[model samples]
Target: MSASQALGGPSRCGWVLGPSLDKIIKNVAWRKHSQLVAACKSALDKLDSVVDDPVDPASCTPLYGLSTSDTDFVLQPLIMALDSASPKVVEPALDCSFRLFSLGLIRCEIDTPTPTPSPSPSPNPSSHSHIFRLIDSVCKCGALGDEAIELAVLRVLLSAIRSPYVLVRGDCLVHIVRSCYNVYLGGMNGTNQICAKSVLAQMMIIVFTRVEENSMMVDFKTVSVAELLEFTDRNLNEGSSIQIAQNFLNEIVDVKSKEGIAESKLCLQLEYDNSEKKGEPIDGEPGEGADLSGYSKIREDGFMLFKNLCKLSMKFSSQEHGDDNILLRGKVLSLELLKVIMDNAGPIWRSNERSSVVKSVDTSVNLDNKEDAASDDLCISKPRRSTRIVIPPKRLDSYLWAGRKSREQGKS
Candidate 1:
């Protein structure tokens, strides 16, 4: 008989060692720094062996047979270790967690059978919970340290987001938004903020692509555009959200151009130039062609986000006191964001009647303010050049104030 059979089957084997593993994991929290690091390294080494096993299927891996509760028990301590002050403990903890996450994904695959002509298969509940807990842990790790840890956290996140299991991907999406919002509002600086924004940008691309292809596993209702906008709005004071929004809009613009703006505008346009063309309406069920409804919804939501940011910018500008350099910086960032948004979403802007009318009004105003050569020569431009030179010092002051604010916020 095989070793598994001799041990009274995989389930029995799991039951036998579960308690021992449980005890070891529990003691991890109480161990001294050195002992804790050693334990994490030991656990990681063992897990690495199983994870790297080429001969055994996932079901035959060491972690596959543990019950859900036992699995969680084993995972909880390692996850907590990710927050350890020592990099030695956190690194091994991160590795161990990632290996466990991989095994969980494998277990999920084995539990869920291939689809036939029947109804769609649901994800395994135990595996779903396991994966979600791990995802949350990894998300928390994003704020732990500098470049190395952030890169590691990002690697874990990318794996989860790109997971073949739809449920895992969906859970990943939710946690990413939560993590981004937390990191942004928590006023994390330097690498932490960069990591959060990078992850957010990556998630936006994946979500947008999924929606475009009608392959998104979760409903937009679950992770609504409104919630995403709030996440962006909350970080406006720091200007990171503006950068995030700018990157997303840039991607949307590129995608629209590559996919052909005419196709996307089909649903947006009130009247089509080709009246002779007859087919299903753009809103109707797509036969052989791709659906345009998704594109339309994306455009609507993108514009909504853009509009809200603009309003927030105005609100911040109006509320700014001379001493509040933070608000002043926010306004500058918002202006930069507006410039980028207009450039990137030009197609959408041009399609809007109000924008076109505003553009015309601005052109007329500029023309009305035009100066003659004699008058322009009489007005020295030195003051304008001097004002431009003064901006850098003001920007430096705002940045210093922002850093102080972040530190105070953290202290609070």
Candidate 2:
């Protein structure tokens, strides 16, 4: 029998899936955990035949044709299932949801056309809206702490990044970046906050390292450092923007360190004499003399991103005043970020340049101290000077003299 016929015809396919979903919702509402698990399994099995393992693409027609209400009805229970404590229920629900998502059958929202006097009112929402919804759902689901669920969420995100639809891919990238910024800024809480932090780190590693691989099929055009910074600045407050700028700088330093290690290994491999293994395929060995050329673009983009971040942090450090916790944290993170960047990208910004940046940062910190002292005249008899100064090695004289020169210039 054809797939639709096997599910009692396309018209009745919803019927086959609906009862199980309804039971899931009912059991969940009643707190009947065992029954809810069973219902979820049954729903997943039906979904597999109809959506996941259809005889052909046409077999999913019934699902695609579901009315907006019916579609919402089907999705509601699955979303609820994602919140269940039981892994059995959460796993099946996630699978069913991902299947529906991949097949473009999930309509995240229904758009009702407003009656317009004009001939052309705008286009309906893009079909890819479902991808965003799916991501949001998976990331916010309570079961995200589960290792399996976390992996599934990461897989969904990476797959979306590789989507053939340019709109879908670009939107997904922007959504992930925005979500990361939101989490960092404390705009999100609970499971969503945790999921965003974990996913962003993993996604950064993948995008910076393996995204250009032809085997991965990820469109490299969607990953732009400038666009990332733009989105981050748009989404974050001034203080949070500085914090995220430092965060990106740290990530770049990390990737550059890894690349440096890989290059060192490649050099050692090339120097080793392997004449005894004449017939061996030298390139086949994993990480042995592998091509590093693909990463050159990433490295250049990373350096450009680093330069922009430095400028941003410096701007904020010079402009922002007071001892606000967020601002203080941003300053600390920026200092650490500069240290890491100097360690990793020292060739690009020389040792003397590093000392200059440090000196500039130290001056900003002291300015903050003077402002703090001025505010508390009743609590203190005299304006205190910071005894401890941060000085980079072999550059004590420059840092000390630069700070004194700046102070004398301000006094004069």
Candidate 3:
């Protein structure tokens, strides 16, 4: 019988293998499912200690263990029910699989034939597709799970970022970017290393560029104006001469309050309003929705940061302000900081004005698909959630040297 049929759903595990492994869910009670997990884990264990090197591909293979037939059976049921599975069992199991694949305990035999039409169709179009599925699913699960599961995933994540394969590394980086982005966008607070305080500070600096520029073309008309700004402005220009003026503006409008709100909430509110409006049904142009449709507002507010500094400069320029060189220098620095924000954030002073560089980032699928430069080892450079860990180079050399020394000493 086919693996899917033999191992389809709860029946196979419940009636066939439950007596031995003893993981029948009772309430959800997937018997054959547990057996499948065990079988998958056993196969994965067999691949442990396999070597991975481009010059010696066999070094990374017990290729016979993870054939196409095996992963198909394993992935199907688990994914279909992942969202519904009890967190206690499923999260840990998925974590184990993720770590197994990352550690090379689970050997995979991929048939990456040349791009040609063949008489028999392949079950999977590409060898790397399953690896993608595993990473995607586990991250999705991690996104939904509690602290423990997410932390477990982070550990496995730190491992996958070290993978040798281009596709795997790229996929892991995308996950890392997404995961970090979600934490920030999700309104998470405190010093979580996975997201990190310093990184958030850095990202806020990165975000000061307008959504169009930072998103590099992803189009934030899909996002809100407030969110776009909050995600970007991370307390830039902290200790310059504009303190009184920035404070006055802050007092006038609580700019920081919006930053505290999560994008998910904003997105939901807009969704609710859309739903209510739809129920009545009378609108034109969809009201431009929540995103900022024009540059005037951002320019107006951002230039407010410059206004006080500009006043100070005007005083300096007119020689009204004495050679209290520190004051003059502070004014110059404040204006410089404001200009940086404006250039990066992308708001036009006049409709006819042109920026030398377009503020749009190339947030294209194509960009993520390409391999990331070695930002660190194992970076595929995709913009998902990712992490980094230090591994000693010549790792396998240490293993080989120790093994060889042991054999020689024994012979002596």
Top candidate by TM-score:
1
Report the number of backbone clashes for model 2: 0
RMSD of each: 16.4, 17.9, 24.4
lDDT of 1 by residue, 102-154 (tens): 32332332112223532532324444454455566667776765445655565
Q: How do these models rank on TM-score, best leading?
A: 1, 2, 3
- Judged by whole-model lDDT over C-alpha atoms, candidate 3 comes out at 0.33
TM-score of each: 0.39, 0.34, 0.33
Model 3 quality (TM-score) = 0.33
Candidate 1 deviant stretches above 4 angstroms: 1-70, 83-86, 96-127, 143-147, 166-175, 181-195, 216-412
Residue-wise lDDT of candidate 3 within 303-376, one digit each (tens)?
22233323333333323444554343333332233333333343432121222111111111021212332121
**Pairs of colliding residues, candidate 1:** none
How well does candidate 1 score on lDDT at residue 412? 82
Candidate 2 worst ten-residue window by lDDT: 376-385
> What lDDT does the true structure give each of the candidates?
0.38, 0.37, 0.33
